[model samples]
Target: MSQTHSGTDATGAPVNAPEHVIVIGGGISGLAAAHRLAGAGVRVTLLEASSRLGGKLYADEIAGVPVDLGAESLLARRPEATGLAREVGLGDDLEPPAVLGAALWTRGKLRPMPKGHVMGVPGDLGPLASSGVLSAAGLARLPLDHVLPRTDIGDDVAVGAFVAARLGHEVVDRLVEPLLGGVYAGNAYEISLRAAVPQLFAAMREGRSLIEAARGIQRRAAASAGGGPVFNGIRGGVGRLPLAVAEACRALGVTIETDTAVRELRRTPHGWQVVLDGRALAADAVVLAAPAPVAARLLAAESPAAAAELGGVEYASMALVTMAYRRRDMTRLPYSSGFLVPPVDGRTIKASTFSGRKWGWLGEAGGDTFVLRTSVGRHGDEADLAWDDTDLVRLSREDLEAAVGLRAAPVAARVTRWDAGLPQYPVGHLDKVARIREQVAKLPGLALCGAVYEGVGIPACIASGQRAAADILPGIVAAGS
Candidate 1:
């Protein structure tokens, strides 16, 4: 349930005016904010350019079974998403992965992923060797991290460069690349360490052994969670989250308008005005939950500096090929949950998840068929995306066959393309976001929040949206008073 707010005057009477906030965008972030504001008795008018809500979180049917075409898992360490799910009556359906581990297909073999890692930064060297992710020569050089002279990273360094300096190129190429790709779809060499893995970056700044630092961090994480699940998913699908939030918004009396794009956003004498469907909708405040480019265009006139900064924020496009196969096929199942393919592996499919093994619920619905998803086309891989869905499926199967030696035709297949789906946090990205936020602060009643500003995870996006709502809530109350 949304929290209550104390907005009444000392005598518990009406103030200057009713607080009204116009929220732009219909993604998870915007929906969450609208829900909160509405619960606080603030009239909310939300404008979504698309025909439906849930920007990237989507649920669809495949072979008569409900499935998610976009993000599917939630990091349980963060309470934002899981907490909201409970508030929306999804608490009973929360589940963790059945299998806890994954594999890596690299260097002409399938190997177990090394354990004790903070995004591929190894805390223990034993698993790295046992997993065969690195060669004997590669393993030999890991100890040099102790003898090698200390390296200095000024403000921030690329994750690849920093890890390679400490661990080795092999670790960055095979371990870090695929791990980062699962979320960023970008090269590890260009990802910002400070932004992507802050704890590890802080460890590096402490001027100690990264291995020891990783172990310490891992111990703290384990102690904090008390050995609970690290990740969770809804029984139906993660895509259901947005729908629940939207329904809650409705219950709170939020006016949600779909296919209503905000074409113009201008500052008025009172506060802010948004022109949509040829009519101006004015409100005391505005919350921006759109993508960087969309937000940039909307705020260009009011704050050109912020708009330019947002425009510079880049994005990565990718596609998913989901296929269901009959269990009778003459093949074997992967021992682990799935496998990740590093970009250096020279394969078309970047990663494959054994949904059947990972999600026990998927087995309950999928009686005779085993389902899995293959992801392809990361950042700087435009040529791979040029192929149509059919060819994409073919290439995915080809790569799957080479990796797992499964030639059985898929009983059913579905391809979903996400053009510029995820934002890319290159080096110095946090600084850019800081500049954008600072510039936006100068404009009254204008706040921006999305995957571009802080984080790309569902929880992070929700937090960002809630923060935006909180930032303007005080001003909205004061203006009304």
Candidate 2:
């Protein structure tokens, strides 16, 4: 017999509903799952081991100003993040990054980042040379990619190998390293092209030179449709995204608990048994929306195979040093958004975001204080985190003085360190995810979703959570029936 129950949609529209769902993880993904379930009229309970609801979507008041301590922006193209915002009454609050270009700081000089490039692959030669990003030899070697025959890429390859082979190491070091670093905080040589930049990989498979493919991809993006900022942020900060989602979940009758750690998960004759704060909770379905390690631990006894595969996933840690300076304290600030430093330069800071110039909202609230944040450390490069917060601020100031010519000491400085901040998506990560998913699927009412399994961006995580929630709903219905 098919079971049918009524529940309301995100917009309060009524629809069929499932039974209760236990979401283990209160981050954006977990919260999204709970929200979607409640919208569909399913009972949901969200447990967060930490005191806060947002995992990495952290925000705090610094110098009497509300600022995002974690992610600051969401990719607008991915409708997941933006769509959720609208459902939660955050649509009007959506803001875009200022229409200002950023630069690369390297070679003891601030160079203009090339305008036409696919993740640092030059689509136009003119900008590449004029930007001073590459040496004379590097510039000369770029053209070689046009004439070289197509290289064979098996199933998958590292992003660095594919790009370096066609454009030489200079392009990878000067261009790709910094750009990829800004996103993954991992080495290009180890990051998967298919996973990280799928469009670039698909274009490369067309049996054309990497340079031409990159240009074609860029041309497509340009010729597509309306032009707008690629990313969107909340008026205050992206940190509010999770808060709004949690509130929406509660409005839908979802029970959300914080400071409650799920110590264990066991498969019961009835859905599953969740051990949390020494109490057992029953659920018709379970959604594991946590980091790889935590998920691995929870699933270890139930499914050792899945645990082993997930344990292999590695992570990278980093720290964000945010500083505020009085406008009068600095002689001048750069006209553009900010800059990135390649790993090859051995700089302590990897990238900087000119918050005041990039986000008009922050600037308006900041008044005379110009705010920006510098990222430090990456995969296999985390010695900077060992230094005290004061030293980290000092080193960041020194780098800024050289790169941006800032001599003013910051009136407010805060350092937020994220241990295991990013998960490394090495080659064949997709395959591993597939295997893990298959094993977990064998047990009805169990589903997994997170950055480790899918894309790392906020939108991707939301999509994964929604998809997982949808997948498990059928099982919930069937079990109850």
Per-residue lDDT, model 2, residue 38, is: 83
Candidate 1 lDDT by residue in tens digits, 1-481: 1223434344766434337889999999998788777866788998899898998898776787677788989999888899888877789989998965899999998888888988998888888988989888788878877777666677888999888887789999999999999989998999998899888888878876778778888889999997889899888778999999899898889999999988989999888889877699878889999999999999899999999999998899999899888866725867678899999988989999888778877767777887889999888875798899999899999988888888999888999999999999899999999999999989877888889987999998888888777766642221111
Residue 464 of model 1 has an lDDT of 82
| Among all candidates shown, the one with the greatest lDDT | 2
Q: Candidate 1 at 444: error in angstroms?
A: 1.4
Q: Each model's C-alpha lDDT? A: 0.85, 0.86
- Write the residue-wise lDDT of candidate 2 on 333-437 in tens digits: 788889999999988999999887888889888888778889999999998899999999999999998898888888899999989978999999989999999
TM-scores, each model vs. reference: 0.94, 0.95
Among all windows of 10 consecutive residues in model 2, the one with the lowest summed lDDT is 472-481
